[model samples]
Target: MWPADIEATARAIIADFTARGLKVATAESCTGGLIAAALTEIAGSSSVVDRGFVTYSNEAKIEMLGVEAATLAAHGAVSRETAAEMAKGALARSGADLAIAVTGIAGPSGGSAEKPVGLVHLAAAGRRGKFVHREMRYGDIGRDAVRLATVRTALGLLGEISQEP
Candidate 1:
């Protein structure tokens, strides 16, 4: 189940998407399938949610979403470039008019010299030639908190792109 505000946002997005005849897809990494799970938890979401790619690993990102090996190698998994490609790839692969991708280092342990825990990059693309991106540095929040925040951010990105003409 999703939290009250999260579920509310999902419902609103589904309603708006349904009204606008827009469908969405998700490509997720650190948040796993949480973004997809939130939307699908709502009733009548099937019409607006085309599919979700939970590309948690680099292989899955390449195989499922067509995230290039060079992108991953040069930028790592938790990066804006990877996030944008994931969104674009999902849009290309799915029937959706809009897609969102999330990549992040959400952890109690996966911090490094440059990429620290709770550093999430989000991106969304619309068939109407709209694109949006954001980077969140949530600090070393707990794994659950980081993941939850990512889900929220990802949904917000999707919502924003869906409104474009």
Candidate 2:
């Protein structure tokens, strides 16, 4: 995912959100703060980026994003349920108009028969009852690559959410 054009996508997303007068927040797991970093790379992103949470651990997700312990225990952090909850929690916690959450296994070790490495779950939640979720199989790209892909997907989700009616 590193080689992806993530910065360009993030810039476009920031421009769209700014144009729409929307504030954004991020809850990140496998990608850490890469999505936030990408957004802040733009000069005036402060107007749109409310905050970012790098909830790399289950406890942090529960504590910071209000992801329920039962959700994590039942579906694991990489599931769509966790991602959706994370997005909603970020929105509630930061008071942002829009939020994106990403959780994934970007690893050389975490791959299993069912949930393999590079399996990323992404979700976006907006104030207007807009919800978007996606599962991506990037196919064991390196950790940096997978994380970069996840960031790109997250930013793209923000862009799409801003366009929703």
TM-score of each: 0.97, 0.95
Clashing pairs in 2: 1-145
Tell me the tens digit of each residue's lDDT in model 2 across 14-132.
Answer: 77778878899999999889889889988789889999999999999999989999999999988999999999999999969999999999998888988999999999999889999
lDDT, model 2, position 113: 84
Q: Residue 131, candidate 2: how far off, in angstroms?
A: 0.2
- Candidate 2 weakest ten by summed lDDT: 1-10
Model 1: clashing residue pairs? none
Runs off by more than 4 Å, candidate 1: none
Best by lDDT: 1
| Candidates' C-alpha lDDT | 0.91, 0.89
Model 2: lDDT of residue 46 = 89
